[model samples]
Target chain A: MPNPTAAMLVIGDEILSGRTRDANMHHLAGRLTEHGIDLKEVRVVADDPRAIQEAVKALAGAYDHLFTSGGIGPTHDDITAENVAAAFGLPIGVRDDARAILEAHYEKQGLEINEARLRMARVPEGATLIDNPVSGAPGFTLENVHVMAGVPKIFEAMVEGLLPTLTGGQPVVSQTLRVERGEGDIAGPLGALAERYDALSFGSYPFIVNGRFGVNVVIRGQDEAEVTRAMQDLEKAFPA
Target chain B: MPNPTAAMLVIGDEILSGRTRDANMHHLAGRLTEHGIDLKEVRVVADDPRAIQEAVKALAGAYDHLFTSGGIGPTHDDITAENVAAAFGLPIGVRDDARAILEAHYEKQGLEINEARLRMARVPEGATLIDNPVSGAPGFTLENVHVMAGVPKIFEAMVEGLLPTLTGGQPVVSQTLRVERGEGDIAGPLGALAERYDALSFGSYPFIVNGRFGVNVVIRGQDEAEVTRAMQDLEKAFPA
Candidate 1:
């Protein structure tokens, strides 16, 4: 069977405005790939509520899983959690369970939970909280959408915890062979080989090293033995 | 009016599968910002024809311009040119002008243009070719969608050449200030300040430096005087 598909909705103005280079998409894509979940599409939208809700509705409805990163902070600009709830037409407020988690977490640090801090405890009705070990505020999951924080370290930690619980297909394995010749010379053979294999995906990434054009032919498949065989086949077909 | 709203469609499997971190989006976002283009959204889709066509239609229609990177190469995976033509219901074939340019480039390097190399010369009907100084293959502009190469240097070169011919609005300005306090403590005052200076967008990016939580508050606006005033107002309001 094919791998379970996933899509990501990055909710932020920072990325679109060129204020911050998005580190979460690459990290999430890598983690999902390892967990055997095929991340198919990723959309980076602004902090606008309409944009967030529209993306949430579209991506969540289209893919098996929809992951979102950013705008889950205590600040005013952080409006993802509420907008996500609105997208699903659910009631959102500070839940007792989430509040307790924040209270205990803040009590340990001898810091009182202010209104801003209390904002993080807000959860939509019928949503499961995703643990954020890096910080006190927990991310939440509503339907097929997983809403996580924008911070890199916190996002990574949340993903590490969340990925294991997801149902994934066979772990894909990939092998690459670097050909010193230009991609134009290798396209014919590579295309023929790809057609022959049919199941494995062949990606040709070109590079220029020492003023010489070359291509890195990456063969990816669920079966490791098949990937190895394909690599061997590639080497034999190219002959250096 | 809104800095000529723009969106990006990144076409590749490398980004989605997590093998390659996309440098193009960040580069494009920064360049567009400098060129006074408000990049509102960015979508990264696979090499699938349906996905590419769907994104092209959606983004191109919604935004003033849609910039695409990748899938314009000499390999079999390079299917963007033909698919883009199909999206607009336009016929695509190798044009003489593009063929002449590629032929001259390859000839200068003592290389013959093969069938695979010749594929790069294919242009959609009624499209203008975007020059690619880094390589022989040229990117093209079909209506508002600008198709560029995937390679970082080549993509950058295409963008540099393309940006000049496009219309732009006022260049956006930004100022950032680092505060050595948790976002929770700063949220209330920051929110109030944001309400006062409605024209400027304030983004609070949190970080942990030496076990202490802090936020880098970035203030951005098209008006330089307004951005500066807002920054000064922020400093005065926070007083730290």
Candidate 2:
């Protein structure tokens, strides 16, 4: 059976405006790949309710899983939780369980659970809370959609808590061969080799280093033998 | 008038499979921000023709401009050009101008223009070529969509070449204030300030350093005076 497909929806204005470089997407991509979940697509949208809602609905419906990062905070710009609720037609309010978690966390630190802070406790109906070990704010999982915080440390922690629970398929293995020639020099043979190995996925990443053009040919497959064989063929096709 | 909105479609299997971290999206976001083009959305899809075609069509139709990076090479996985053509119902073939450019580039490097290499010359009908100073395989602009190479160096070069020709709006200006308190401590006052200055966009990015939690409040607006005033209000709301 094929691996369960997943998609990511990254919600933040800091990312859209280029004020912040997104680290969560790359982190999730690596983690999902290791969990044997195929991350098929990723979308980054600003902190707009309509955009978040639309992306959440579309990705959640299309894939077996949808993981979202960002906009789940205490500030005014954090609207992801509400928008996610709207996407699934679920009524959202500060659930007692979530509120209790936040209240205890704040009480421990001698901090007040103000109105804006209480916003972080708002949870969509019929959702299970995902543990956030790094911070007090908890992430939530509604159906197949997992919503996590945007902070890298907190996001990574939430992912660690969430991944082991989900079912996974065979992890994909990849091998790469760096060729010291321009892509144009190897394209013909590389193309022919890719056609021969129908099971393996072939990717060519071009790079120019020290005024010398080269390509890194990456061969990936769920089956290790198939990937190895494809790599062998690539080496033969472009002998050093 | 509002700034022209843009979206980016990043095409590559390397990115989805967690083999490569995408740098082009961040670079484009920063550049587009400087050019006063609001980058509204960004999508990263694997090197699949259907995904590419669908994303290209959707982003192209919805936004004022669509910029794509990746899969524009000579290898078998380089299918972005063809898929982009299919999205617009444009017939694709080896255009003489594009072929000539590639042929000259290869000749200078003492390389052969093989069948796979010739694939780089395929251009969609009624499209204009975007210059690639680093390598010869030219990116193309079809209507409002500009396709560029995925390599960071080449992609940056293409963006530099493309930015000058397009019209831009007033650049957005932003200022940030770092507070040494947890977000929960400042959320109430920050939310109230955000409500008062509706024109400025306020974002709070929380961080945990040395076991101490803090938040960086960023205020953005096209109007400098409005942003400054909002920052002043934020300082007053959370006096040190």
Candidate 3:
């Protein structure tokens, strides 16, 4: 069976503005690959409601699963939950279950559950809460879209809880050979090798490190042995 | 006048597979910001031709300028120029100007201009070349879409050549205040402040640094005085 495809929507002005380097996309990509879900595309947009709503609808409709990070905190900029709810035309308000989670945690810490803090409890109707082990605020899943926090620690914890519940296909395995030659020098032979191993996908990434130009040719496939065989072929084609 | 909006299409499987963290997006964002262009959205798609074609069409139509990085190399995996040409239904092949540039560069280094090396000379019909000072392989601009290399050094060089040619509006000015308090505590007052200065944009980013919870309130606007005024309001609202 084909692997379930996933798309990630990262909503934050800070990321688009270059104020923050996104850590969630890389973290999620690695996790999804390990879990046998193919992460097809990723989008980073500003924290605008219209942009978020549009991206949510498009990605949710296109992929098997849509994972979103950021803009789920307790601030005016935290408009992702409401925008996501609006995308599906679902009514959203403070849910008792989510409220209880936040209330109990704040009470234990002797902190007041203020209005802004309570905003974290406002989840869309018919959504299931994804537990946040790092922080008390709970992320939620509405349909196939999983909403998580922007904070790396909390986002990772949410992903850990969420992945086990979803079904996945065979994990993709990859093997890479570093060819210490310009891609142009290797492209011809590499192209022929790629055609022979049609089941595996080949990616040539050029890099310039310490004034040396080289290309890292990576072969990826679900079958481990096939990936290894292709890597061997590639190694032979571009002899060290 | 409002800043010209731009979108970036990052084409690479390495980024999607979590093998490489994308440096181009952050670099482009800062440069565009400095040049008074708003980078509204960024999409990272895999090396699939269909994905690249679709994204190129969408971003090119939606934004004032579309910038693409990756896949413009001399390998079978390097299909960006062709996909981009296909997106616009334009014919593509090795252009004389581009071929001449690569031929001269390789000749100077006493290297043969082989068939794979000649692939770098492919250019979409009606596109103008963007100079690559780091490498001889020239990037091109087809309509508003600027195609550049994925390597950071080359990408930066291409951006430097391209930015001066494009018209930009007023550069966005920003001021930030760090509140060593949770976002929940500051969201209420910050929301009120954001409302008062509707022209400026307010962003509340929560962080956990050294195990201490804090939020950074950033106010951004094209008007420097307005941004400063909003920052002051944010400071007064969340007194240290």
Candidate 4:
């Protein structure tokens, strides 16, 4: 099977405002990787409907799966559901199934579900609900777009519930070798090694550790033996 | 004026692969806030030219300023200059001024200015060069799109060089009050305070410290006195 490509759309002005350091992206990245889904792109847009629609359409068309976070709240800024509906050209209303889920969820908590909270039941038409175990609001999957909550806990729960249903490929395994050397000095050898191991992806991340330059050489691939061989060759080329 | 809206496009597959935890977004967010520029969006794209072009055109048109990082190196995957040029419908080539800068830089380093190395000198037509003190490879300013380096050190240097040249509004000042309370408990009062201060932006960040729920109430505005007053009010409302 071809690579399972994925894209993430993070919808919230709060993230861009630096008010919130998003944990969902990291969570999804790791999970998707383990599921053999290569997350190709990540776009963090505001709560604007047009922006959301444009991003949803563009990303959903390009990638095999599109994961969206945020803007599924009670406030006016919560426009992802409506915009996503428009993107897929689907009519949106209070989904009976989602309503049932939310009602049951609230009933268990003995909480009064008012109009403000009931707004969470609204979902795009003909969409399968992605269960939110932590929150009452149900995320929906429409044409490969998985819309989840902005809150990390809720988003995580939704992902956990959703992942088991999807088909996945052999997960990419990776190992890192830390070298106490500058990137410029190691760039030539690293480039050659990357060219040799065309199947595996290699990355050289440079960092300063206590005023000393160091590079972390990462080797990633689906084949564990091939990745190990490449790592061995890399170690031989640049012995610690 | 008009909140000085801006957007950031991070062009790299490394970030999505979790090869690197991003420092650019946080640094840029802080800088933009200090410059009174409200960053409305942030997109992380792969090294694909089409993705780069699409994101640049959309964001540049929507925002007052658009900042891009990565995909402008000497490597084959570094197509940011060409993509950015395509976004603006401008021809990309090695400009004389940029070539001169690179030539001088190379001469000082006693390095050969090959076709591969000269790739760094290529800039979109009708663009101004951004100074890079840390690295010889200079970033460029094309219209409102600020093409910056991927390396954190170089990116930060470019930002420092560019910040003073741009027309900045009154710096946004922020005051944070850490209260020993859960967000649910403080949500009501925080919402009221947010309404009371129409000129300011307010947000509640909730975190757990030592198994206790704690909330940090942030009040941000241009007026120092007003922000101080708000902080004083918060202190009075929730003493210590």
Instruction: Report the lDDT tens digits of candidate 1 across residue range B20-116.
Output: 9999999999989999999999999999999999999999999999999999998889999999999999999999999999999999988899999
* Candidate 4 stretches greater than 4 Å from native: A103-110, B72-79, B82-126, B170-240
Across residues A128-149, which tens digit of lDDT does each residue of candidate 1 receive?
Answer: 9999897789999999999999
- Which stretches in model 1 have alpha-carbon errors above 4 Å? none
Encode model 3's per-residue lDDT on B1-240: one tens digit a residue.
Answer: 788999999999988888888899999998898899999999999899899999999999999999999999998888899999999999999999999999898888788899998989999999999999887999999999999999999999999999999999898888889999888888888898888889989989899998678988889889898787777777777788
**Native contacts kept, each candidate:** 0.83, 0.82, 0.83, 0.36
Model 4, A1-31: lDDT tens digits are 7668999999876677666777788789888
**DockQ ranking, high to low:** 1, 3, 2, 4
In candidate 3, which residue pairs get closer than 3 Å at backbone N, Cα or C atoms, i.e. clash? Answer: none
TM-score each candidate: 0.99, 0.98, 0.98, 0.81
> How far in Å is the alpha carbon of A9 misplaced in model 1?
0.8
lDDT tens digits, residues B1-240, model 2? 999999999999889888899999999999998999999999999999999999999999999999999999988889999999999999999999999999899889887798888998999999999999988889999999999999999999999999999999989999999999988778878888889888888899998898889999999999999999888888888777
Could you give the DockQ of candidate 2? 0.83
Across A1-240, the per-residue lDDT of candidate 2 in tens digits comes to: 999999999999899889899999899999888889999999999999999999999999999999999999988788999999999999999989889898888889888898888888999999999998777889999989999999999999999999999999989998999999988778878888888888888888989899999999999889999898888878888887
lDDT of candidates 1 onward, in order: 0.93, 0.92, 0.92, 0.82
For model 1 chain A, give the 10-residue run with minimal summed lDDT: A207-216
Return the candidate ranking by TM-score, descending: 1, 3, 2, 4
C-alpha lDDT of residue B62 in model 1: 99
Docking class of 4: acceptable
